[model samples]
Every structure is written in C-alpha cells, then in structure tokens.
Target: TQPIIVTTTTAPQQGGSGSGQQGGNGSGSGQQGGAQDLKEVLNSKVSKWGDANGDGGVDMGDVVLIMQSLANPNKYSLKDAGAFNADVSEAGGGITANDALTIQKYLLGSVTKLPESYAENIKTVTAPATTTRATTTTAKPTTTTKATTKAPSQASGQKFSVKNGQNQFKGDSDGYSYEIWLDQTGGSGSMTLGNGGTFDTEWSAQVSKGNFLARRGMDFDRTKKATDVGKITLDYAADYSASSQGNSRLCVYGWMTDPLVEYYIIEDWVNWCPQPQGGSKTVTIDGAQYEIFTLDHYGPTILDNQSRNFKQYFSVRKSKRTSGSITVSDHFKAWADAGWNIGNLTEVALNVEGWESSGKANVSKLTIDVSGGGQGGNTQQGGNTQQGGNTQQGGAQVQAGKKLCAISFDDGASAQSTSDPGYRIINALAENNMTATFFNVGSWIKTEQQIKYEYQKGMEVANHTQTHPHLGQLGSGQVRSEWEQCNSKLKSIIGAEPSHLMRLPYLESNGTVQSALYDVPLISCAIDTKDWNNASTNDIVNTIKQAAQNGSLEGAIVLCHENYATTAAAMEQVLPWLAQNGYQNVNISDMAKAHGKTLAGGQVHTRA
Candidate 1:
C-alpha cells in the first residue's frame, strides 16, 4: 500500500507537556482507495465496515484493534478488506485513530451512526483513557542536606521513604555499585534497592510533586573525560506504572565537571518528554535515530547547594522502548558530533527518574558496565545482555534436520497505524517463534522505526524496489538506483543494507535487472499464496497446505503479502499448521544457511 505523507510544522519552545513532538500522525486522505463520497462509503451494504476483526459486530474489540494498531502497527494492524469499513472518520482518509474514535463515539451513544467527517469535530471528545505525564518546568533538586554515602549493607532489601526533604544512599551489591536518591517537595515517596540491578520505587500522587533517581554504574571522580570513562553499555528491563499527572524517565544520567554539564541519554520515558528550548534535531546512533536537545538549568547541583547554572544535553530516542541495550558511548559520539562539549565525567550510571508522579516501577533485570576506567568498573557480574533469549534474523541456531520454509512478504513498509500489514505479520510470526523476510518497497517505507522494529523482532528486512516499477523494463542504472536507495534507507535503521537477498517487483526481472543486482542474491518462491488478489483466507491456507502435503514445502519459499488482510488471516492458520506438521518457518537467508547452501549473489535462490 502506498501511504500518504502529511507534512506538519514544529515551533521551537521551552519544555512543557503540550504536544511533545510534531509530525504527521500517518492519517491522511487518499489511502487504500482514492477519495469517495461520504454517503456512498457509509451506505455500503457489502461488508460490516467497522468490524475490524470480522467478528460480525463493531464493538470495543474493534476499537482495541485500532488502538493497538496505532501504538504498534507491526503487531496489530487491520490490513484486511474490512479496513475500508474501519476508515469511517474521514471519507477516503486512511484508517487511523480518528476512525477508532468515531467507532468509540458510536458505541458510547455520542453519535447515532458513524459520521462522514467525525475526525474534524473530535476536538472536544475526551479519550476514554489518558496518561497524565509531568508538565512541570522546574528542575529537579540535585543537592540535599540529608545526602549520605555508605557501603553496601549486608541486608538484602533496603527501603527508605522521604516526605519533604531529600535522602541519598550509595552502596555496592553483587560486585556492582548503586545509588538511590529521592527528594520531594510537598509530597512523599519510597524506594527499595534490592541486590544487584533490581529495585522498586513508589511515589505519592496525592501530594503535589516529588523526585526519585536510582542509579547502578560507575561514578567518576570528576577528573576523566567522558570518553576516557570507557565504553558504557546498559541493559535493563522494568515495569513502570504511572499516574497521568507526572513523568517517568529511564536514562543514562551523569554529571560533568569544569563545564558543569548534565547529560542524559534518555532511552525511554512516559508521556511528555523534556523538549528543551529551540526544539531538537535528529541524529542516528547505535543503528537507530535519536533527537538531540539542550536545556539550561539554574539551581543547586550534585556538588553543592549553591545556586549555579548548567547545561543539560539530551539524546532522546525517537522510537521509545522499555527494555533494550543502550550503547552509552554512541550518544557521546553523537553529542560531540553536534558540537556539544564533553567535560570531565563526575558520574555515569543507569538511572530511573520519576518526578511529581505517583507511580511504581519494578526493575526485574538491569546491568550497567564501564570498560576503560571508572568507579564500579568491575566485571564480576556475568555479562548476560541477551534480551529474553530472542535471536535476530540470522542469529538463531537452526536445529539439525528441522523442516524449514521461508515466508516472504512484499510491498512494505506499512504506515505506522492499525491498518499496517507489516506489523501484523511481524507479530504473528513472533507469536509462533518464527520469522520471515519483508520485501519492502522504498516509496512505501515510512519511518526508520518500522525497519528497526522488523530487525529487532528477528525478521529479515529486504528490498523490493524504490518505486515498485517493472525492473525488467528499466535500464541497469535505473534498476540499481531502485534497490540502492531502498538498501540505503534500510541500512540507516539496521546498520547494514540487506546482504543476502533482493526480490524484484512482481517477480518481473530480466538481464538488466539481474546485472544491476548481480552482487545481491535474488529470492524466488516455490509456493505462491495469491492473497494479494483478495483470495479467500481459506483458499490461501489450502494452497500452502497442499504444498506441504505434496512434500514440496521443505526448504521452500512461500510467497505472500503482509499488506493484505487475507494474507495475514491465512498466516494465522498456516504458521501453526506448519509448526504442528514439523515445518520451521524462517526467512530466506536463514533457510539457506540452515541447509548449508552458499547463497552466492547473481543466482536465484528457489529453495534452501
């Protein structure tokens, strides 16, 4: 599907909880099909238009599908034909949260029937649920009269509650050092530091505001530069539940000497992130994009209670994730590239900070390490950075003698919304512990986050073309440009272009196309499920089942499109059936690798 791009403007301003970031929400006119008359769209009697899940009714489940699709288009999307019915808010407008809201209003009796332009009048409608994040412009207090530094307590569970002032503790556990700090103003909060990288914090929402920062990592002596502090990487997993009125941030927090700089490599946050003045600029680091912002703070600091000013440098992630590996030095390099000064490192640690919010967070796993030189720089803690044991596209070890099949999708990346087919397909594959290759069209690609999401989910992200043109009819130069541009975009997200495979648009290729992509292996399917033609889900499923029954499924590539709802539905049945019948679903590259076949470029790979 070709997504409609909407352009919006952003005004520079100070940090506050208004609209955090300004960009197209991926909802616009001219999607799925061109603009249609509102009356004709609403009066259609062919299908249950609003039934997102095809359950014969439009209900909360439909609303939920839309919401989940918006939040995570890769996993829960409405690529089915019913998506047309889901686009109710605006005639010919793509399926968006506005459509979800329209359905919600109908169910709530706010509207008797879905309106043609409900999106334009949704200004006063309060969302059923909302998360209130901290909008306070005040800086967190860094100095307290109750500051204390102590060795690791022999006791395992150490807890403290602060009502009005400040309490800070420094200790070491499991060969790693940690610090817990809390300061409240007209409020109260509590924190419990467990062994190693495990801790929990709860703050009072009844009062006005409070602050908490828990750190686990090396603390410098304000003598060495940030680069000299060594390679810093943090892996953490936590469950953070917050009230709607405050803010929560998970980051690599540190202070610097000489320049009096406070730096934050914010990996994730709750609603309303700190925007800083003059807005922010985008930068790519660690194979993902981040927004760089600088804010000035005037107040007491960690070193003293005297009023002083300092600059806060931030590397906020564009795609926020709760649990992941953070290469802290990548941000350091990015900041330096942006002409930001790197001062003497005073402290560097994995920190969880909450302000003016009544909520709780339980960190089940966390690890922070510094290599070159710094405090808490020990290597006693086992280096277990694997995230829940899921592997990347080529990282998974194939079991010997396992029946392997490749399921490939074309015409992606989908827009970041509920109707996105890529997300839905990715989620389904993940649920079954399988993976596939997404042959994404360059023009259809939306965000770098989408490509990153695919790779992060252990799926192969490949190139279809820049414009889905007939590569077989184009010159070699034109053909090269198509795949080259798409490869470049994918590289920006996943750190490398697709190495093992490329699929021609509509499988239409010739000598020119082959010559242009001579160094990139081409993938051909052994089985075709023509769900893109609006084939019934059962028919698509049967096509694959017949292939397996004929003993031609092993080491075969099963072709389909994630952009079709019918294809997604067929996969729901096909994946489990494949698994149950002793077939392992994998991407083309992995399938080849599993069979010990050398996937040389310039040759078409029809099977493992």
Candidate 2:
C-alpha cells in the first residue's frame, strides 16, 4: 500500500483524531479550502496512471507536472515514486509528453479510461481532530515551470554556447539528434537543448550576420532520397516572438542533393516572408493555405560551400500558427504534381531561423515519425506515435474487439449509370454501416460525378490502370505510363489520388510491373468472390461464408468486381453477416493500420 502524503498550510487539530473516507474525485479535492479554512485530509485511493503531482487527483495540475517534467527535466524531473506514478502509457513505457497528452485527453473527456486500468495499492491516513483556535489557511496554487529557462552558465559544461563567427554544433539532446548552426558575425545567439525534445534559444540584433538555426531531425549525408527515408510527419509546439524589424522564419527546412534544391514549409514568420512569383501555385495543408514558390539561387548551400545554380521551393503559409501537425509527404506530392523535381534529401529538420533579428523562441515539444516510405521501418522519439482515441474508419470510431477486413471492387466499368453496379454496392455497404475500396480505370469513369458519388458514400476510389491492360506483358516504362495516366486522371477529378495503392488488370503482376512501381504497394486479395464470372448471387455469398468458417476471413482482403450486378446483390447478404459476427468492413488503408502492419512501397499485400 502507498501512503497518501498531503501538504497543508493550517496546523493540525489538537484532538485525538478524526477519520473519514471519500470517493476519489479528480477536481483537485486534495487541496485545502482557502476561504472555509477546511483542511483537505485526503483519505482516498487512486490508480497511478495519471496522478503525476501525487496530489491524489488526475486533473490539469497533474497534466502540467508531466509537461514540465518533459520540458525541463534538470529541475522538474520526477524521481523514484513520482516517476513510477507518471508512467501512464498503456504500453508502460518511460515518461514522455505522450503520457501527459493521454492524461489531457482523459481530463477533457476524450478518453474514458487511463492506459492502466488496475487500481494502485495507495494507503490513506486521517488527520488530527479539531482545535479551538482560529487559523488562517493559504492555498498554494499549482504552478508549472515555464519552458524558457535562463541560459546555462559556463560552469554547467552542457554543450554549445552563443558566440561570434560561424559555429556548427551537433550531438544528441534529450534522446533526439540535433544540430545548431550560428553564423553571427557580431550578434549574440544562445541555445539550450532540454529534455523530451525541447529547445530554448535567444538572440540579439547583429549586423553583417548570416542566420541562426537550431534544428532537431535528420542531417543526412545527401545519400538518401526523401522516399528512401519513407513518410515523415512532424508534430510540434512552440512559443515564438520576434521584433518587427528584420526577417525571421519558423519552418520545416531541408535541402536536396541531385537537384541542389532547398525547400521551406514556413509556418510562421516575422515582418516579411518570401512570396510566390509567376507560374507558382497554392496548396492547402493541415487546414491552412500555402503558396508554393519556385525560384533560382546561385550561392553556397548546406551540402556545398561552392557557388552553384540551384532551385529553392517554398510553401509559405498565408496564415501563421505556432503548433500543429504536418504531413510532409502531402507537400511532396503537391510539388511533384506541379512538375517540380525533388532530389535526394540532405536535411529534414524543424528550424527556428533568424536573419539578424532579436527575439527568443522556446520549442517545448517536437516529434517526428518516419514510417512506410519503402524503407519498411518506423522511427519515433520522445513520444507515442499512435494517434489518440480509438481506431477510426470512414471518420467513425470502430468499436473495440471487432475484427477488421477490407472489401475491394475492381474494374470500374459503366460506373456512371444509375443502375451502375457501384451504386448498388455503395448502398448495400452503407446500409450495413461499412465502406469498401473501388479500383477505377481512367477511361471507364464516365464523369467526375461518378467518382464524387462514390466518395460521398465514404467509399475509397483507387487506381486500376488507365486501360486495364495485362500488366505482366508490359515493359517497365509502359507499366509506369499506365499508372501515371490513371493517377493524373484521378487527381484532376478528385484533387488527389485515392491512396498509395494500385491494382493490376487481371492481377497480372510480374517482375517488370513490380520494378516499375517500386514505390507503390500493389494490393492483391485473399478471397475472390468471383461475382464477375456470371456466378449467381448465392455462389458469391457462400464463397465469403466458407472463407469465414475456415478462419481465413479475419483481416482478409476480399475481392469483388464493380461491373457485375450479381456482386452488389451478393453484398446485401454478405455485409450484414460480417457485421453481425463482430467484423468491421474497412478500406485497405484502415485495415492495414488496424493490424499493426504497414503497406510498404514495392510490396504486394494480400491481407493485413
């Protein structure tokens, strides 16, 4: 049993003792009342999931403590007992900002339970009884240490310090790799790396100065392309302020090798920012609009100090924000669609850069997750990468314990007809509260409205080749052309390709087809309903049921053709049966994520 420790301002009563027990309330009930002079003698127990401050409540105060512990562990680190209590993750890992995020979700009613469901063996105690004398009680308000800590003294012997002239520092900070580059000719710049991927920096005005940038992410040797690294997503939080004069940019900055290009997804800036010129475009990402600018630069880059002609790409946000998530791959796709070439990645980092500006910035949280960029690996630091809340499909939460399966329809022929097989299939799936994927051919989709109707029903539309050619007989160039044509048509209609998935005509994939589309995951199927072979509706239904009886339907990718009326008729019976048996019909992407599997590039996936 764990003893309940209480801090009180008023003196204990002078009688023998008063004993009482109360149910655990997470409303800061352990604190002594300020006006009433009632001492909160906590005689209750709580699980160790979220009570970070040891105050006997899982409330905002606990959340603040967990965040503080991550931001500045030197002074606010939870030691021994507090450390054990702060391990709130369901995985029972060490303390991180994710633990605090989980507690915040719970306090905000986003989650009903903490990761740990077991009750702690906390012991409770009673206080001494009433005294006759009047006592003044002063309540101590919970305070969280701010992220902006003063610059460390030289005696601390931490790492890099602000100085004049060019200085580049590289090492690990709070379990994350970081690099700091200061090119100040006369100004002053200070940097301090903190716990759990946090950084604090300050700078003074300087003339004839380059720029100061502190970053946390990859500083590669220009050997790997962005695709070689996989999909990169960044989650960041910071407090940024700068003077009106001089230029400053808070962004995700990187460089490319072969093309010798530089890029910036500028989230916030001070005073002025780069603007899009002629032939430039705009793309919306993470709920904000950004103007894409392409221009030439003839100067030294991070990779090469010699003068060279290169390109600089900018996705400067029209409006600014200090905290949010960025799906970096979406920007890559948008740039690629606009006929701009991106090359081998040299650096991908969250940068706080100032050009002769005087200001301070504190990045309290930073996390980058790179997964499924054909590298077939996942890297996460300083946080939990799993998305918060239950697994979601079609924007609705899937109930716990239900098995998930992806149902796909192929060959989108005559999808615009009112009697279109896709319409019936979509209606049937919707009636049963499910969704499926439709592999569409470019030419067979008669109108954009046909694709829009499918999307309106929460159905995913994927690529099935432009003309549905036999892919095994095609050369690598031909296969790529087919894929590109289909994707181009889909993007023009839907504003984006359906997913990173493509199905071959007749499922006739060979080495050439695989080699040509090495960056896309070819989706195959485990169960073929064969509804397109003039099979009766009962035959299609029984094929699926037999697979379920054999225990092969769980997490399986089931295939059917969208050109057949019999397939739609069969799904009327098949979808309801699956739902009744505790199975959820999801698209391929959702099923892959649900089963802890990644649909990596250059691979063929039959089941999740």
Candidate 3:
C-alpha cells in the first residue's frame, strides 16, 4: 500500500467583495481575502521585521499581534507573511520568545537595525541567458546522484500482533496490550496491527460516532507522582489517508488518575472533533520540536467514562514527522509549570483515533526509561550505593584496597579564582583527561559560563555552602540555608541539582549540621594538601607524592583548591605524576563506586 501524504495550504476565498483585513484574530467577513492580501504584500517585497499584523509597520501593535498568536495559535496563526516578519532573531526560522525580545529591544533603542540575514520578502527571477555554440557541443552523459533511502523494516510478531475483523483486544510483550474498538455500522476498511516494540501498526477504519481507536502500549502504576518518574520516551512513524470526508489522528495517550485527567501527545491529526485551543509553546525533546497545547474543562473521557472536571495537555509536533523520539518527562515538566497539578502517572499508551480513514502507523521504537522517585520510593537517595553488608551512619561503608583516588577542588568560582590560576588548573586537568570534583561556594560563582563549561567538560559540580561558613558553629537553620541556597544557585547556573554530594566548609560539621543535611552525603578529604596555607608548589607536590609513596593514595579523596596560584602550579606536576605512578584520578562518586560504597548524607567518607 502507498503511504499517506498530508499537505497544509490556505485556499483563496470565493466571492469576496473587498480585502476586509483584520488583525489579532483571523476572523472577519473576508478571512481568506486577508490571507490573499498578505501573500500579495509579501510578494511586493516591502515588509520589515516585527510587522506581524501585516500592516507594513514595525510597532507595538506588531509585538502584541505576535504575542497574541503565541498565546493562542488556533485563533491566530503566523501562516506565512507574519511568520516571515516576526522571525527577527538569530534563530533564523522560528517566531519565538527570542524574536519578541529582539523586537522589544529595538523599540527601546537597544539596536539600530534588525539582523542582516533576515529573509527579505522578495521573489527574485533570473532570466535565461542566450547561448550560441554551447548547444552544438556534445552533451556529456549527465551524472545523477540518486538519494539513498532506507527501507522500513518488516513488522514481526514477538508478543503483539493485529489484524482486520470484529474489534478485538489482546495482551502483548513487556506488560503491554492492544485494543481496537470500532463502530462498523458507519464505515468499513481493513485494520491490521503489527510489529514488535520497534514499530507501530497500520490501521484503517470508518465510523460515525468518531470512536474507532487502535491502541498499543503499556500502562504504568498511576499512583506514582511525576517527580518519581525519571524519563519517558516514545519514537514512532505514522501515515494517514482519508476520503476528503473522513478524519483521523495518531496520538500518544497517557492516562493519569486521582483527578482523572488525560494527556495526549498528538503526532498527526486530520479533521478531528473538538478543535484544539489556541496558544502553543514550543519545546525540544530528544532532538524533536513539539508545540504544546492545553485545554481545561474539556469534560468526560473520550471513552464515554464518568464526567469529571478534567484538563488535557496535548503536545503536537509542529509538522508531521515520520520518525522521532520524545522525552515525555520534559512535557510533564512543562505542563506542571503551566499550573497543571499533574497527579501520579498511570497509563502510557500510543494509539490512533480514526473516523472514515484508512492508513497505517509504525511505532518503530518506544521506550519509557523511568528513574528517580516513585510511589513509596525515596527521592533523597543518591545514584550510587555502598557495596557489601556494612551499614555506616550515612548509608554504606567503603571497602579498602581500591586503586582509585578522588581529586576535589574547593572555594573557587570567584573572578580571581577563574582568572589565570583557575584557567591554568582547568587546562591542566583537561589536557590530562582527568576528572575532578569541584565543591563550589555559591557567592564566589561570578563566572557562571566558565563553571558550566567545566561541567560540560566532565568535571563534577558539587556543593560547598553559600558563604563557606563554619557549619558546626552556625545554628541548624543557618546551616540548612547555606546548603540549600548553594544548591539552588548551582541548579540555576548549570540546570542540575547536586543532591547527592556536598562538602562542609572548613570540614566543619557536627550532629546538628549532619542532621540538617540528611539527604546529601558529606565528602571529606582523605588527604589534605594544605594548599590554603600558602604552601609552595614544591611543598604541595611533595605532600601528595609522600601520600602516594606511603600507599595512602589508594581510594583516597585528595582535597585542593583553585583559589591559590601555587596549587594550580603544583597540579601541573602532581596530576601527571599521579597518572604515571598508577593512581587513577576520578570524582567522589566514582571513587566511592570503586571501593564498593554508596554515598549518603550524615556520614563522612575518609580513606582508611
């Protein structure tokens, strides 16, 4: 069977008296004529950036139009001319928040002109040049390079399969099931669901009630909160065809309970009922972009379930895609940010809804990789755990005799630290392909970009209190604020929260401090370089060299700081020497893993 092809284009209106152009909403007596006029204006080649209302002007009205379109895409679409004018940023192709900010800056006199590379609304024509003797010359054999195309894999039955006949439902592999409910009284067509977990099935159906559905996917425990789920991913490919009077859609259905709400990620839709609400926010997940739409008070489930006040968030692709993977967790985050109190995730299903349509969809691949907190699961636990049956005050005990050493830097994200000495230390570690743990002081993090660069380059960013105070001397509340504030700042800077590891300032901690930090493990140095005492380069190198010679470097946590020029100079020699002398440099978590230990709060890990 041939694949279904979908096209989107605005048709010209018939019998329009005049171009009754209207802005904001695409509603007017001559809506199609307005579109036609906009296309003509674009063809005339005289529009500038930020002219979203298509009135040939760059002003606040244009900004308002763009904002309104973004807030409600269904009511107002950029379509063509508006899209071309509103896209003024370096992003080049999309009308996004960045473009809106650029327009605002221009209005505020922050810029003189828009981006030079912005596409102009001009249609250039090249007249064919007249050639005299070229036609007489023998035309050499033209070389055509045929584009290579990969054939889709044939569907195979492992645990799930589908076919045409009366509606049926069955269970499949990996705790998944397939269900097809069709109202045959309205229409007729062949429906077959096939493929292992790697692909989707081809489905065709006709119905008047708009109730034909073919579902294939798994259901998770709905009682677990969204925070507990780590990652959910779906990769699929779909094709649809209709008889001009038919309608169909391919969507991923996730049913959540407690409040009984449904979440749908629609891959494609054609002439479906209950038109989507306006306003769309774009998000990139798993390298694919999706336009998210939210609808509230949509009323009872599509399956005619009990009527309950429910909300729905649909993440639809900007364009129909044949194959792409989406990280479902990110969408959940976006919904939550929009004030949707998402309860525990219950069911994750990928299916198609059709009305008088015929076609097929292949899942190709689908995966739900859930990690972190869940129902009855502890969210404060770190990723690494201790080996053996030994239980320490924090969590587990580290075994001895592991040839691993953790190199840590402390108190040094300030401008002074990131200057010559800091770059020197960072360069030395990068050149040596060594990984180090940085316990950063929150207030000292002046160069956030540089710190994020280090994180991207494989260095671990842990917590060192905000003010580097003596935690044992501070009150319990102050201690908690110090750590929590530092963590919050780190997350804002690097988009990650270091909930697993932290080191107290001046290595100061007591029962109160430990009690306050019961979630993050306390990391103390097994070998203190004493570089903060203004130790000379030679002195610092000798301190570590002596430790290595004494065999105390095994499974050792070496503490140093980038704040000192002497420390940076010493590392140039110490790091290479450690590598040559059989000591493997790693982060704290890795060192703990090597020694069969799990890191948790309340316990200090010291080399034995």
Candidate 4:
C-alpha cells in the first residue's frame, strides 16, 4: 500500500505546527466542480476491467485476512472467528460475503451503473507510454561527500525561506496540518509530506514550517479579493522505496468567505513544483489565513500554446471529483485563446459569495473584446492560440491524434452554381467517401431534385448567407434577413427550418450577430488553406501539406470554397495526401465533440 503522508503546517506562525486539519481547501477544486457541467463522460468511476489481481475492487488483500479455525468434522465456518477488539463499525467496515457476489456479477457484465465517485480519491494513470512527460533525467551527482546536519536553506538568490520541513516542499498547509500538491507534468521536485500522513517529526530548527496558499477572485465582486484559505489534497500513487515515495499530487479549488461556499475538490497534479520569486507578494487565502502562490508556478497549457498552428483537446485533471477527461471543445477556446488574453487584464476580481453556483457576471470581462459588427481580413482580436486540454489526435509517430477537418463545396450558393468544376469536385468527394459539410445557396434549392439529393444523402446543408455579402457591414435587421431568406429557401426544399449555421463569404461576422442567431456557434478556421489568396493551386495544397509535415499545422482548419475550380484540381492531391500522411478528415461536428464543446438539447449540431 502507498504511504499516507500528510503535509506539515505552521503553529500560528511560519515553521510552526498549529493543530488538526486546515479549515478551508484549495482553489482548484472549485474550478473543478464546474467540471460536472462541462463533461459528457464521467471520470469518477473506476475501470471495471482493471481488477488486475482478480479480486473485486472493494475486497482485500487487506480487509478480509483470515485463517480457518476448524471446529471438528472438517466443517469450519466464519461464524466463530475471533474478532479484534474494534467497534461494530470497524468490523462491518471490512469486506463481507455480499461483496464477493457483487464482483462476480460485475464480471458477467451485469454491472451497468457506476458509483458516483471513485473508490478512493484517484489513482495515477501512467499516460500512454508513446508520449512520455519525462525526458531522460541527468544522473544525480555521483561522487558525493558526507553532509552535516543544518537548517533547510533556500536556494541561492532565494525568494522565500523554508520554515519547518526538509529539502523540497509540496502541498498547502492548513492552519492545522495538511499539504496540497500541484501537477507534475513539468518534472520531479522536492515535496513536503512525511511518512504515514504524519508530520510529528522534529525539524532541525523552529523556523522551517511550510504551506502553499494563493488568492483568486470571484466574478460577482470584481473587486480583487481573497478567497477561502485552505490546504490542497494529495494522492501518492506509486511508491519508490521502503519510504513509500512514488507519484505525489495536489488539488486546487476556489473558496468562498462569509456563509462560505462549500469547497469542492478541483484538479490535482502528480508533481507540484515551486514558483519563481521575482516580484513575490503575499495574500491571505481563507479566514484563518494562508500564503498564496502565484505567477511564479503558473504553468497553464494556454500560456504557451499557439493557435491555428497548434490545436488540441484536453484530458481530466486526474482526481476524486472529476467525471472523466474533458475536451475543452473546439468552440471553447480558453487555455488556447482565453489564457493568452487573460494575461493582459489589468484588474483582478474579488472573491464574491454565491459565485460557486451562478456567475454570468464574471464572463463580462470577456465581452469587452467583441466588436459591434463589420470586418474580417485579419483578427483585430489578437492571436492568442486555442485552449489547452490534452493534445489531440495522437500518433505514436506524431505529436497529437488524427486531426478532424472538412472540405465544403458551398456550390448551392456563390455565382458559380451551374459550373462543371464544382460538380466534378462533388463526385471526387463522394468517391473518396469524404464526409463533408455542404452549405447550400438559396438558388440551388430552387432545383427541387438537387435540393432533395443533398438533404437526403447526409450532406450537411448549413446556410452560407443568402446574398453572401459581408454581414458584419449590414445592420442587425439586414443580418436577420440574410439568415431568414436563406432559412426560407432551405425550408421550402428540405421541409425544415435551418439552424442558421453558416460560414461567412469572407468567413466573417461580428458581436452584433448574437441577436440573429438563437445560439448558433460561429465557425472559424484554425488553419485556413488560403486557396483564395491568389496563390497557385499547388501552393495552396503544398502550404497545408507542408504544415502537416512540419508538424506545425497539426489541427488545421483549412478553408476552401467549392466555388472555385482550382480547389477541385487540388482536391485529388489534398485528400489522398492528408490520408497518406495519416490525417483523419472528420466533419466539424465530430471535431467539436472531441473538444468537449456543448451539444444542444438532444439536437446535436454538426459544423466541421
């Protein structure tokens, strides 16, 4: 069994041991409770197939230890077994005969529903061996000299001093005694937990106690305030030696003051490291208090990810509370885009109560960037990159998974409706079994036969604005007519109103559009194939192909209009080339799902 080590705490002062567990919790857990709202699959359940020891999960090696006490006639029963002097609750806590029956049923596949949470916090999953987080670590210095006992000194040019623990620190300290941890994808570092969750050992001196405390704001208050100060939770997975050292972790959460927001366990990390101490400062975390850690150790994926050039999905935070791995939907660009922009905010939000439940006011900070309407040559919105979750479409050979992409003909509209080139491209896509999104023109639906063929054959007939003008330049009412006219034409033929899904002529729109769209997500390209840029046909295909090769545009959102014949000429190579190179051409809908964007109410929207 892994050792259950606990974090040490300050005794009303730095390097001191106060008492029982801390009063509050981490900041990350509160962030994670929102996870339940964001997920499709639950990560909290244990794997039914992971009974490696062939024992029911709740059974023991540990709890059901026994010896036969035969009472003659070779007929022995557990009825007369000598019981330990523990209470009835302790005896009942051990495994029972009914537990065996449950496992037996589980293996038969009769077990359908999973429990609400994991058996115990969460276990560490060694991520796919193909993509290792650790590179070969340099060996520790070999010729070592005997060292003398002394106080734990901070590293040179050190920003903070260690109060009570030994070399290296981990976890947040409660006013009492506890340690929260951090994610360890970066690499290994020193920790603060001692043996068996106990911190009763003596420090070389009285000034070495430690804790990790940080402050975060609430949306309602926006006044830049501190939150519930508390210790983080840790789950040590694998043990390295007799000392029980293996994987170390921590959980962060949002805390509330006043009546107090019930704390939830948020995301946890396998390895937590120290932050740099350049412009370091202190803030109280909870009412009892804690020392907050900030930008020094902030290693969010978005802070470094680049958009268009880099695309991805996300995995679960690996903890007790999570339902399953979360894909921060392609529509939801946070760590990728949001994180980059958040770095520029000058003011911080204050901790407001009741935010843990309903907090739409907080997102107002985001609305400041939305343009009223009109424009789309280059983004005035600044290039921040996509959100960070897990890298998508992985290959043992490449960095991420097979990227989902699409090629739409928009032949139904555009001036080139009755052309031979676009028709030729359609045949090519069909022959290739390329599942494509085909947004139609109002004029094409007038051809009753072709309109029936498109809607019936599973080609997605989303709207491309009726007149195909820059809707951004139009007034809100005109934008409504643009969508309504297109919707009317499509409804006349397809017999159903369109969802008003669109890919702008210039692939443009503005903040003013929300009034027209019930809730349609705007489509934007991550990596435009750029075929319309007056570049040669080969240049367009080559640009995309080269991006796939150089591993830069792995999750590219290449845009091409079937309205052009050059795109048709290049289709032959583009499709086959991406496949030969191992790219998976999924529709926009699937890509959105993989990224964990919200699907409608039983109305799964398809946009590739």
lDDT of 1 by residue, 447-565 (tens): 66777787877787787878888676788898889878987777776875454367756655444565466456666555667776667999999988887897767767777887777
TM-score winner among the candidates? 2
User: What TM-score, computed on C-alpha atoms, does each candidate reach?
Assistant: 0.36, 0.41, 0.37, 0.35
For model 3, give the 10-residue run with minimal summed lDDT: 133-142
lDDT of 3: 0.54
lDDT (tens digit, per residue) of candidate 4 on 434-487: 444556656544455554554444444566667777766888788778777876
Candidate scoring better on lDDT of 1 and 4:
1
Worst 10 residues of 4 by lDDT: 134-143
Q: What is the C-alpha local distance difference test score of each model?
A: 0.59, 0.59, 0.54, 0.31
Report the C-alpha lDDT of model 2 over 230-309, residue by residue, as the tens digit: 67777889899887767788899877655668889899999888876667787888788988879887865542123568
lDDT of 3 by residue, 145-182 (tens): 11011122332432222222223222233324344454
TM-score of candidate 4 relative to the true fold: 0.35
Error of 4 at 460 (Å): 1.5
Candidate with better TM-score, 1 vs 4: 1
Error of 2 at 586 (Å): 0.9
Provide the lowest-lDDT 10-residue window in model 2.
133-142
